[model samples]
Target: MTFENPAREEIKKILERADNVAVVGLSDNPERTSYMVAQAMQARGYRIIPVNPNADEILGEKSYPTLKDIPESIDIVNVFRRSEHTPPIAQEAVEAGAKVLWLQLGIANEEAAQIAESGGLTVIMDRCIKVEDAITGPLKK
Candidate 1:
């Protein structure tokens, strides 16, 4: 399965509009990329939900084991897991009613992107939310 990516303008719109971002595969280890990215997002005032089985807390917020465990509706699911592991996470993000599935820089899975898109979720692959935030602007109106 395959589909076209949202245009640069549309991707920017989605990123600018999204509020709560659930960071799947987030880690408590401060050295991890997910942790660093989540912290950056939080510092910029975006709600960052940490999803990791190994963590109870990260960046002073409660960590969830999965996307389904997050109480609030997530605007975007920033995936930090490997490409091989993204399909199920994408499925979970869809099941959790996320508006977008964002695979981090260097991570891309056409199958997962297709699933998320087919389920009415916007998909952004091989892009870093943190980088996007830096280059663009806050996810705000």
Candidate 2:
């Protein structure tokens, strides 16, 4: 079966209620797309938890080596990793009890989507969270 993302209104609601975002593969460098997107989301009031194994910190937030390393609850697990690498992350997000599994633009993995969905996560694939927030966020300025 073809993978279809949730409708726009549903995505809006997800952004509205979300408070914490665990950004997997978020980069320390400001030039990276992951860094820029997470920074914008942070400015919009969502707590940004950087999940980067190689970085000590990103955007002033302490970086965790994995989703399981995060101590608090996660509203969204936003991923910047390649499609081939997402299935394991999906499992981790499930283990971490995240509400949503969001794969960033240009990345989508069927196995990952299935895993997250089976684990009760609302999955959004191949969409830019930053753009979605700007378009549909109630907290947008």
Candidate 3:
């Protein structure tokens, strides 16, 4: 089956109600795209939870080795890892009970999308969360 993202309005509503964002593959370095995107999202008032095993902390938030390690509820599981690596993350997100699974730009995995969708999570692939937020406007608090 072909993959299609949720409609713009649906995406807007998702962003609007979302409060906690768990960013997988978030980099410790400020130079990485993952860092930049998470930073932008944080600036918009979303709590950014960094999921990086190698880092102790990122963007002032304690880093977790995996989604299951996060103690709080996650609204969105924003992934910066490669397409081939996303299926497992999707599974993790499903187990974590996250509301949405978002794959970053240039990354699309049909298997990952299927896993997320089947697990009852909203799936968005090959899209930049930062760009989508910009177009969708400031998130509701």
Q: CA lDDT of each candidate?
A: 0.88, 0.96, 0.95
The 10 consecutive residues of candidate 1 with the worst lDDT sum are: 132-141
| Candidate 3 or 1, higher TM-score | 3
TM-score of each model, paired residue for residue: 0.93, 0.97, 0.97
Model 3 ranges with Cα > 4 A deviation = 139-141
* Model 1 lDDT tens row, 1-141: 445667777877887788899999898889988889998888887888989888898898899988889989999999999999999999998999999999999899988988898899999999888888777764443
What does candidate 2's lDDT look like per residue over 19-137, in tens digits? 99999999999999999999999999999999999999899999999999999999999999999999999999999999999999999999999999999999999999999999995
Across 16-130, the per-residue lDDT of candidate 3 in tens digits comes to 9899999999999999999999998999899999999999999999999999999999999999999999999999999999999999999999999999999999999999999
The predicted structure with the larger lDDT, 1 or 3, is 3
Query: After TM-score superposition, what is the CA distance of residue 96 in candidate 3 from its true location, in Å?
Result: 0.3
Predicted structure 2: lDDT: 0.96
Q: Between prediction 1 and prediction 2, which has the larger TM-score?
A: 2
User: Candidate 2: misplaced stretches above 4 Å?
Assistant: none
Which pairs of residues collide in candidate 1?
none
